[model samples]
Target: MSTSIRSIKSLVPLLDRVLVQRIKAEAKTASGIFLPESTVKDLNEAKVLAVGPGGLDREGKRVPMGVQAGDRVLIPTFGGSPVKVGEDEYQLFRDSDILAKINE
Candidate 1:
């Protein structure tokens, strides 16, 4: 799929939802040996592409989200809904579902 931000920007998450693209697993090992595709482990790292407006609180205030677009985040090993845009794969998770923000 086209990895252009333009294509991904077309999707706008809603109500605290986030759209994330997983960071691909490395094809090469630490010693520089090329690992087969089947042996590559899926990484739990992801890049935040888009985020929804914060959800409303009981007091009718908008609760701001902690993570923003362009942030690198750590995700759980499983449980997000998968999304397919062209040949690319993405995941949808709520703000609370995201594990942590990664600092570069």
Candidate 2:
């Protein structure tokens, strides 16, 4: 688990919801030149911090979520509700809203 996750374990998402922390944008160029904040692009990649228990189906059976905590996932360019815990910034997204899992 990531350090950021450890600090916010108390947050338990509900009913297929997921908590995610975005991967930081690069602050330097490949040539070692420092880039200004204005040049930094917000990435669509993020680390899963917490996952809610699977939701119930029509038959009352639990439908498991595709992703889990500790997984790196790809998110949409726009959407997801931003969350703030202390100085950290997190986002809440529905399991289906997550685009894909990043294998690394």
Candidate 3:
């Protein structure tokens, strides 16, 4: 499913910001039983979608971001600005706010 939010097919987030698509928790169990939404744990993992240009530093130098598109990152459960397009939701976070980059 395509989640790009821009009308022109590109969504380059601005300055030190990152666009992330959250990973939804599974609704089924190992034995093929269905689970209720309330029982599912909210996943903290997200896939990097689009990113902005690196932010500038006080010294007039560019500060590099730690995560990039296609990188899997760990995010906090309750923060980040939410974005909704159609019926899907995404998140926007400053690079400094991301918890960590997941290797897998």
What Cα-based lDDT does every candidate model obtain? 0.88, 0.88, 0.85
What TM-score quantifies how close candidate 2 is to the native fold? 0.88
lDDT of 3 by residue, 1-104 (tens): 34545552265788899989899888999998999989999799999998888899999777898899999999988778887776777889999989999996
Q: Which segments of candidate 2 are over 4 A away from where they belong? A: 1-7
TM-score of each: 0.88, 0.88, 0.85
Every model: Cα RMSD to truth: 3.2, 4.2, 3.5
TM-score of 3: 0.85
Cα error of candidate 1 at position 18, Å: 0.9
Error of 2 at 64 (Å): 0.7
Question: How does residue 6 of candidate 2 score in lDDT?
Answer: 45
lDDT per residue as tens, model 1, 1-104: 33454476688999889889999888998899999999988999999999999899999887899899999999998788787777778998999999999998
Kindly list the per-residue Cα lDDT of model 2 for residues 1-104, writing each as its tens digit: 12344457788899889999999888999889999999999999999999999788899887899999999999998888887766888899999999999998
Worst 10 residues of 3 by lDDT: 1-10
Candidate 2, residue 36: the lDDT equals 93
